[model samples]
Target: MATPPYPPPPPYVPQPPANRLGGKHKTVLGCGGLLFTFVLIGAIGSACSPTGSETTKKVPGPAVTVTVTATATVTPAANAAAGSPKRAQESAPAPAASAEPVTAKARLSNHVGQQLQAAQDAAQAEGFLVLTSHDATGGNRMQVWDRNWKVCSQSPGPGTLDTATTIDFGAVKLEEACP
Candidate 1:
């Protein structure tokens, strides 16, 4: 091999102290490390928290009582025999004890501008059954599996004392504007 004209350059060595990080860089690195540690701790704490599947026992509240009174009616034929006390007593039946009311009246809440499932849940929570009506005129077909419909209007507007056990909801697809 032919010898080179110039001698080979000295081996390069990095000066450690020349490129050392400054006070600002150290401060930034420390802050980033602390932030990362806090974030990691927060994530771990969230992971350890109870999820939906975990249930806690609830303490029950005091019981409520309702009183009702029942009245009995006597027919004319039975009353006619009232002249004979024994006969009248035998003919007339004993009055039954009053029972709790068949249905409870609840104030209905307006479900307008709410999602269908949320509306249904709210109604049902107040002891009312939900009856949903879908608007298909907008070219969208309603399906049982789809719950993304929004309620446009509700029957028995908000704060109405509802005697009926069922409440009606008029709903349309989420993409459609309310009527």
Candidate 2:
């Protein structure tokens, strides 16, 4: 038999091109890379997060009457790691028991010209906890951050008073003087 000039056109085969990448493949690959990048960033961020600590004050004991202040720092290897917190415990001497009822009184701290937070801390240290403060300029502003304000004047002045008295402090911003 005589051969045809084009070999019958290789039986008219229809095959797709091998070198070109399709749009669908590109889209799928791009989405997978983006997802991988986001997951890697989240892992790195979680590793750099801060560890935490907590402060606890004064626990009453049955016989010892001990005053304890405990503080602990927590660290997590993974997310909320299963372990005990590192703690520091402190103790103070307790007074002897007595039958007589003791009256409660606190000598007020000289909080004038002092930072509002410091004044509050000092007063609380002296067994006075019922406290209130107001703007001395009649602005009726709230002292959101006590450290930013100063005590211009305090009620009942600085003297020993009953613990029941609600101590009120008149305060102004650190930049302004009392009126």
lDDT of each: 0.64, 0.70
| Candidate 2 per-residue C-alpha lDDT over 45-158 given as tens digits, one digit per residue, 9 for 90 to 100 | 877643212122332212212244444443333322334333211121233444454456656756777777777877777677789999999999999978678889999787
Clashes of 2: 0
TM-score of each prediction: 0.46, 0.44
Q: Where is model 2 more than 4 Å wrong at Cα?
A: 1-102
User: Stretches of candidate 1 above 4 Å error?
Assistant: 1-67, 73-92, 96-102, 136-140, 163-165
Backbone steric clashes in candidate 1, count: 0
| Clash statistics: count for each candidate | 0, 0
Query: Cα RMSDs of all predictions?
Result: 14.6, 22.7
lDDT of 1: 0.64
